[model samples]
Target: MNSKKVRILVAKPGLDGHDRGARVVARALRDAGFEVIYTGLHQTPEQIAETALQEDVDAVGLSILSGAHMTLVPRVKKLLRDNGMGDVLMVVGGIIPEDDGRELINNGHADQVFTPGEPLDNITDYIGSKIRS
Candidate 1:
């Protein structure tokens, strides 16, 4: 039993002001014993990657509802990799179409994309299964 908590940085990038879902998921990850850092709102890709690097997090969870997924997600992913945190698991959630989500995964930008109505437990389980390898 390592006893180390998995550190997760949950960010609401772009001009999206709606963060209720992000907050709920942050709380859920915390409840699941992961250390969660949530950047409030309107964060730039540079800001998100900088925060993740500074926090030394194991993963990053992006909550995007702003219809700017294609533009924002990839930039953030590139910055994360550029900052030498490429191995950090990146997951996205919120109003993204299935095709778009798959494209993000296929393009190697995202590790996972979660949509609305997804069980919170599934997110927790997925991260738990991937973290310590």
Candidate 2:
């Protein structure tokens, strides 16, 4: 077992002033034994990408409940890709429609899309498996 913990960046983008979900997930990730760096709320794509790069994180968990996943997730993915961090795992959790979630994954913008009521263990396990491989 590689005892090294996975590093994660949990970000809330757009004008979503509500971050209770983001905070919950960040705490969950930390409890799951992953090193988490929260980017706070209303962060730009550039800022998220830069922080991920600077922190050398292995994954990014985007929490967007404002229904801006289509616009924000892709932009963050693009920024990370352009900055040579495309290999980093990108997962989105929010109030996104199933169709949009499928689209985001189909387009390779988000590795996975999590919705409300999803167990934190699912996210943590998925991230652990992905980063471990």
Candidate 3:
């Protein structure tokens, strides 16, 4: 086993019932050697944050496809900030509009945004780079 594990929390927030993307990402991350904790479907920002804290993850990756990225990302960011875990890197993926991606980064809600069909290597590389630095 790798001695250094980059812990990541993959969460599905809001009413998005589609989880195939999230699950695939989780598996990819795991295969890439990161310890992944997936918080199934229909999770709230609060629940995601709490799980991140409990899991002591280095980053939180939220998969949102319900067009609720604006509302959900900020909520998760606020929750992490309130809990003094704001330093935990937040990355989002899935059906996020280009403008919304910029908004998320500007608002400090996400460090990176991966759209549909982005390679798994890119996601894993992003996580590795963030965690390593």
Candidate 4:
């Protein structure tokens, strides 16, 4: 078995105060053998991108329930790209509408968007596959 472990940063961006889902997912990712970093709450796009760069994380998983994903998600993506961290995998979760999720993917804001109630394993598997590929 490969001994390498993936590092992921799980952050709650914008004014979203509901972090229950983010906390659950972060724990689940850690249990799945990922080195997970949970960035409390109310993080800005620049802060998230900066953390991802500084931590040298393999991926960034954002948990946003504020319905401002349309703005925040893309901004983070842009900042990462601008900071030359464009290679990192970007994934988002929490209370997102299907159309918005599709738009995010189509516009390159995120590689995947997980909705509420999706199995945690699905997220782990997706990140694993994307990183290994």
Best by lDDT: 1
TM-score (C-alpha, index-matched) for candidate 1: 0.97
Q: Which lDDT tens digits does candidate 1 get at residues 69-132?
A: 9999999999999999998999999999999999999999999999999999999999878897
Q: Residue 44 error for model 1, in Å?
A: 0.3
Q: What tens-digit string does per-residue lDDT give for candidate 3 at 10-106?
A: 9999999989999999999999988999999999888998998999889999999989889999999999989899999999999988998998998
Could you give candidate 2's per-residue lDDT for residues 89-130 as a string of tens digits?
999998999999999999999999999999989988999898
The stretch of ten residues in a row with the least summed lDDT in candidate 3 is 1-10
What is the lDDT of every predicted structure here?
0.95, 0.92, 0.92, 0.92
Model 2 scores worst on lDDT over the 10 consecutive residues at 1-10
Q: For model 1, name the residue pairs that clash.
A: none
In candidate 1, how many clashes are counted? 0
Mark the regions of model 2 whose C-alpha exceeds 4 Å error after superposition. Answer: 1-3
After superposing candidate 1, which stretches have Cα over 4 Å from the reference?
none
TM-score of each: 0.97, 0.96, 0.96, 0.95
- Report the Cα lDDT for candidate 4: 0.92
Instruction: Name every residue pair that clashes in candidate 3.
Output: none
Deviation from native of the Cα of residue 42 in model 3, angstroms: 0.8
Answer with 1 or 3, whichever has the higher lDDT: 1
Stretches of model 4 off by over 4 angstroms after superposition: 1-4
